[model samples]
Target: MGFKPSNKSLLLEEILDALGQLTESLSWEIGTTNLDNQTEFRALELLWWLDTSNYWTTLYDTINIGTSYSQETIQHFFWDLTHLISRYLGLEISHYTAHPEKVAEVFWPILTNHSEPIEIRTSALNMLMMSQPTVSRFLTLYWFMQAEPSQQMYNFYYTTINSMANSKYPCYDKYRKIAAQIVRFVQHKWHHWSTGNYLLDYEEPMRGYGGIVQAILMANQRTGFPSVLRLTLVRQVV
Candidate 1:
């Protein structure tokens, strides 16, 4: 080698070059002069490599807070990188179940925040529901129940609850407990109606009442059932 740069100098140079390259790479615009489609593809290639390589820690570290990047830059790259990683892995939101901490740190925020894409949020919630003890699934239902109702989310939570309550995996006793929890939780969260009305509001308050009643009925249809849940029908008095 006639003249080679030192490893230290090369590494420093590479870090700065990566920052600039990644920034341009994230955008969709492709210029014919300096940057083209090839440039953008190359940037993604670099990101894929770094994500799989040993230097990923260094790569994320370089972009996260307290680094040389500006707050705006850090936030932009952080979200873009997160979305990129999530997409790379088959949109498998349940993958985070292995890292439960990530459910709160990552998926929960996306699921609860209305600003995120609906598909992404729904997928995240669906995966979360898949990884459960009936209690955890109930909690997930509680969280989504608290959100402004969307038909899709409403249906998803209902279907998930029904499946869990009806499934034989939880045993009769455990299943009863889950159904009781659902009834109690639904009643407490939505106690604005009479004891025997069964109307579907089609709007917010009584929207999911049918599902809750169904759960209660299913729960009581068992041997040795304990005390019945006395929740009122959330129908509007006409």
Candidate 2:
């Protein structure tokens, strides 16, 4: 009378379906839904089990349901599930010392997938960037820079580069190269705004420029590329 692996897999699938149904039955509001604490706890419990049991591949498949499900319920459930998983990863990533690379492998697609909600993507990005291992953080930043750029990509790039500039992350030399590439990309995208006039048309343009300038100066210090910042300043002065 032993509990078989097949039985365990079936039970896991049933649990997931039950959770999905519970999510569907709830109101389809993003922030305004009155979800119970018990539901969140149950989801977290399941995530913990999946991680500890080496079922992360299964969990990855579940989260990446893709855009095929036209039902609003399924879409919202997956979004909520992704957010919960990101939280769980942030809190429990240290426990994954033996398989940090695996964690990255599972979540990188979710982070880079434009179809995913920005909040979910941001959560995944933050979790990976803040993981205890420097390699995970570095790889996360590297992979993100290589991904297709979006309007929000500038903010992410600036934030990551700024953080690396200010921290003693032990990989500054490597990050310096990445930061240089980011500066070039940002410059190319927003070069039209160099005069600071076009930036005035957007909300919080000063804050955005301030971040870019900070990143430029930091990059200058590391790579002796003061001309980039000087060129930016010159453009502003002209």
Candidate 3:
């Protein structure tokens, strides 16, 4: 048989070649636990420092003043990183849950905050909320209450769930459990989110926001292939 690549010697030239390949791999879609496991929290600490290093700075300088990576690249990176998280969830969720900050901060805020795309935001929130007990229910309710929700949004969410009902992934069950917890948790806080000083008119919340909860719950139990986790919302919650 021909020689295998990994079996090659680690001489000075060989070592450098290996590192070159490794660096190239990091930019591509690859699964890695070293950043989260072996290094523990220190890994991200260093990554943040690197994100600001001369490398990214040089890259930042190269881009046009108003240019940004295309939406496809951004989405690809998101999906790749998400798959890494899913692989580690069984091993790290409990630990990451206890120490939320253990997760890389650079990505956490983007995922938790509502400023980003709903799909991305929802995914991160789902993961983070899954570990936070009943607290997330009220939190989502709080944000939901404060925001000016739309009728179109309500239909969109309901439609998302109805669509998921036909899914085949086991993770869907896990999603449903999470959605149910949020709903039950928010039942007591629901009335507080409405306006007490409205003068003219107000829309019924059940007809608006209430439908979203139902749809989200249903979508959670909708299953899919292991590679494509049904964590569109969880990725947002990350």
Candidate 4:
């Protein structure tokens, strides 16, 4: 006999069906009044997916291009749903206080705890990354500092710097500043080594170090220019 579907499987099918329908009709106005609970849940699921996809530019474009839906309304609804989901999963915002040190203290353990389900930990990590940018920057630099010096460490440092440099958000300035600080800290750590050699290693993966070179040229770039660097890197890679 063919296997019977479990209740969980049935619900998942329903959610997926709902998502397919919603994505097809982006021009439709979204509100709780029109959507039943199941459809709403599925939409939130899709939003969470987009949130973690690391394609901030795509997210911005998809939500703003004459979709006829209220961007603020959709954001508010998504945040509200995410908050509920986090609470249900026992990953409440209240659990991580505003104290920068305390926030990292709580979040890092949860993120690195291999015993927890990956989805839950990822959800928690993304939530922290998006909501607590400053703290996230601190954590990224702090961890990099503590980590062993290696090619992988250098790659991560570049990745973070590049992302901050090319970010399109209004707070890209802040992100660039953070990236600059991290870069300086790293430079100081290896001050005895040749900066030129480090830049060569940085441009190795990208086949050229245009952005890295530019960052070096602009004295003010040290304060906040990784976002620009990241943007340049992405353009060149693309």
Per-prediction TM-score: 0.40, 0.42, 0.31, 0.29
Q: Which residue segments of model 3 deviate by more than 4 Å? A: 1-79, 86-92, 101-108, 111-115, 134-137, 144-238
- Candidate 2 Cα errors over 4 Å, as ranges: 1-14, 26-37, 51-55, 62-153, 171-176, 184-238
Q: Give the Å shift of residue 108 in candidate 1.
A: 1.7
* Ranking of models by TM-score: 2, 1, 3, 4
Those runs of model 1 whose alpha carbons end farther than 4 Å from true positions after fitting are 1-95, 131-137, 143-147, 167-238
State each model's CA lDDT, in order.
0.42, 0.44, 0.34, 0.40
Best by lDDT: 2
RMSD of 1: 16.8
Least lDDT summed over 10 consecutive residues: which range in candidate 2? Answer: 193-202
Q: What tens digits encode model 4's per-residue C-alpha lDDT throughout 101-122?
A: 4445445555555454333343
**Residue-wise lDDT of candidate 1 within 1-238, one digit each (tens)?**
1123346545445545656665555442232334533333333334443332334344445554223444334434444444344345432333334445433444555667776544445545554554433576557557657664554444445554545545433223364457546754442323211111121222244553222221221111123232222232333221
lDDT, model 1, position 124: 52
Query: Measured by TM-score, how close is model 3 to the native structure?
Result: 0.31
- Compare the candidates by TM-score and give the number of the best one: 2
- lDDT over C-alpha atoms for residue 233 of model 4: 23
Which digits, one per residue and each the tens of the lDDT, describe model 3 over residues 1-238?
A: 1132343232223433323333334433455645423322322222222222343332222221212432223233333445344443233344335544332332355454544544454444444444443444435533553352432223333333323333323334454554444444232222211111111112344544211111222111123111122322222111
Which residue pairs show backbone clashes in model 2? none
Those runs of model 4 whose alpha carbons end farther than 4 Å from true positions after fitting are 1-106, 117-123, 135-141, 144-161, 184-238
Residue range 1-238, candidate 2, lDDT tens digits = 1123345566577556556645555644535444543464565465455434545445445544422342444335544554354454433344433465655654566776777654455445544554433644665466555654653434444454545444333323465554444444443242211111111111234553221221222122223222222111111210
